[model samples]
Target: MNHMKRVLFALPLLVMASSAFAAGLAVTNNSGLPIDELFASPAGKGAFGANLMEGIKEGALDDGKTATISELASGTYDLKISAPDEGVLCTIKDVKVDGAALTLTAEQGKACK
Candidate 1:
């Protein structure tokens, strides 16, 4: 194939490939029962808002579902999660990754009443 033909053909494929895993953000809460139902939200919701994918796993607490950042691009992204209460303490911190295989944790507990 000629250079131009190859470039043109590969262009769409490249874009699609990137878009496939363009999630850019994710969140997970493995705090274990009881506390696990403390909070929930998408991992990217903290910093990027709607620019990145949002997921939540409140597990039966009506909180939400879990969010995974496994679909992020090859760069540095600040993964974060929302807190369900004040002084309650919920966190998903220091999740820096390159390419993929990134995991962020979210936890919350306080004033469960």
Candidate 2:
């Protein structure tokens, strides 16, 4: 039936749309210091939501390594990367993830040792 055909056609579109918006956060450690925590939350919010990667047991991200932050819905986010002793290494604001993942790196001033 024509109705059935339309439904079938729309199904792929839905899937594609969802996948397009599903790109998550990715952090690349360009700094020489190891990154112990990477947290992201909705922009303009008071607190960070959760750590995307680099936990206590798993160890931190070494220099020149990139890690992905899964389990986040696509949206604008504020990112924070911390040092091994909980010092603030870098803070990035207004990161947008629409159809592709957001990649962040610690450069110069933001790269605290």
Q: Which candidate tops lDDT?
A: 2
- Model 2 C-alpha lDDT per residue in residues 22-65, reported as the tens digit of each score: 54445566766677777777897848866777343447876787
RMSD (CA, Å), candidate 1 to true, equals: 7.8
lDDT of each: 0.41, 0.66
Output the lDDT of residue 12, model 2: 99
Top TM-score model = 2
Residue 52 lDDT, candidate 2, scale 0-100: 73
lDDT of 1 by residue, 10-68 (tens): 99999999886665444343333222222222345554444233233432222334544
lDDT (C-alpha) at residue 46 in model 2? 43
lDDT of 1 at 21: 60
Model 2 residue runs over 4 Å out of place are 1-25, 54-58, 98-100, 108-113
Candidate 2 clashing pairs, residues 3+ apart or interchain? none
